[model samples]
Target: MDSVRTCVACRKRASRTELLRVVVHEGRLVADDRAVLPGRGAWVHPTARCLDRAVSRGSFPRALRVSGKPDAGPIENRLKTLMDN
Candidate 1:
């Protein structure tokens, strides 16, 4: 079975493969569908609003438990990229 994971914004548990895992990588945050990264991770809906919520509320820093040098421009671009497809 696919591992179950939760979306921090929606508070909904979903299959790991069904949700996007956001991680901090080398002082930057990126979404990893591959689920491979060091340190902690957070999940958000694969939608723009949920992603916006996660970024706006500082959830990534809280979940990863690090002070964020948030590159939200990249994040927003990534979400837009996904939504465009």
Candidate 2:
């Protein structure tokens, strides 16, 4: 059976495969395309608006259970790059 995850920004529930998984790597947010990275993770829709909400609302840190704010650029760039490819 498929699992479900909620977007930390929008708080909408969806199938895990439908949302992008993100994790903090080296104190920065990065997308887990294969969802294989160890440690804490949060799911979000792969859209700039969703990403912006996640950043503006400052939910990443709480969702990832980490202290301090992490940069959101890398995650956004990764999504854009994925869309472009």
For residues 1-85, what per-residue lDDT tens digits would candidate 1 score against the true structure?
Answer: 7888888877789998778888877777788878887668888878988887877788778877888456766667888999899
Tens digit per residue, CA lDDT, model 2, 1-85: 9999999999999999989999999989999989999999999999888899999998999999999999888998898997797
lDDT score for candidate 1 against the true structure: 0.80
Candidate 2, which segments miss by more than 4 Å at Cα? none
Any residue pairs clashing in model 1, and if so which?
none
Q: Which stretches of candidate 1 lie over 4 Å from their true place?
A: none
Q: Considering every candidate listed, which one attains the maximal TM-score?
A: 2
Q: lDDT per model, in order?
A: 0.80, 0.92
TM-score of model number 2 = 0.93
Q: Which consecutive 10 residues in model 1 have the weakest lDDT in total?
A: 67-76
